[model samples]
Target: MYSNTSELAEDKLLLLYLLDKIKLPISNNKVTEIILENNFINYFTLQQYLTELANANFINYIEQEGKHRIIVSNKGLKVLSLFRNRISEVKIKAIDCYLKKQMESIKKEIAISADYTIEGNNYIVNLKAVENNSILIDLKLNVASNKQAKDLCAKWKKNSSKLYNELFKVLINN
Candidate 1:
């Protein structure tokens, strides 16, 4: 989508720099949200850049728990180190500030997750909590209706930590 070679290269470097700063595997949706929210690049252009970066071994895309996640490759870090100056200091500072403000929400987004699927006459809800890339809790429930499943997921997202602590207390007391 970019007509200028330098611009394309610089944008790719910008992405790499972002991933390096994150230092964690990020879901595709999260990456898209950040880039689009910042108005750094259009959706189609971002897709193309992601594909090119993955193909060139500059970024690694992996599927886990049915989600697509991306992380910067070692080669990408090297490239960023060499070309990061192409990205303006203003852009870098903006990213740093934004990350600082949103890192907690981002971590919660990555760590707490819930989803549902229809199974026969029931809805199967899956709720999970993760820390440091390790599973802290994984719970599945079979509900009679979609509304029940949705409510369960919402509650799980909001109260998973409290529930986990309570569950732990109950189990230990027994």
Candidate 2:
């Protein structure tokens, strides 16, 4: 049985290890999904540790194009080198397998973009679908409410593939 404090430490280390493996900055949402899959930490605690890591200089966050990406710092690398064994080999393998399976999907999710900005008296929601670092769809729609904008963003992220296929079908059929 692991103590609560020890579990938190493990969670932090696991996160660092994951970032190291990917060797690229990933969004907090991606990290949250991976960690939640393993049931290592709850969502709120995961958010707390992400903040703690950034504050401790163990990790840094880069905000580009209105999205945040998390990268491990040199200090974090050194710490992982020192204490990575605190995480079991089993957990390590699990992370490795998870990333191998989900990395592409995660990248796709990152590539699909959605955001809303207020313009004069309306909310303009911008949605995009990208593939191979190329823009496949760039759409802007004016919506009536903040809630509608938020919902559209969520729906776009969730159903982007379906949307893309349907769009192509419509364009080709016409």
Please tell me which predicted candidate would have the highest TM-score against the true structure: 1
Q: Candidate 1's residue-wise lDDT over 103-127, tens digit each?
A: 8888888888999999899999999
The residue-by-residue lDDT of candidate 2 on 17-83, one tens digit each, is 9999877667988898899988777899889999999999999998755678899999999999999
RMSD of each: 1.6, 4.5
**lDDT for model 1, on a 0 to 1 scale?**
0.88
True-structure lDDT of candidate 2: 0.88
Going through the candidates in the order shown, the clash numbers are: 0, 0
TM-scores of the candidates are 0.92, 0.67
Q: Which 10-residue span in candidate 1 carries the lowest summed lDDT?
A: 1-10
Given candidate 2, what's the lDDT at residue 93? 95
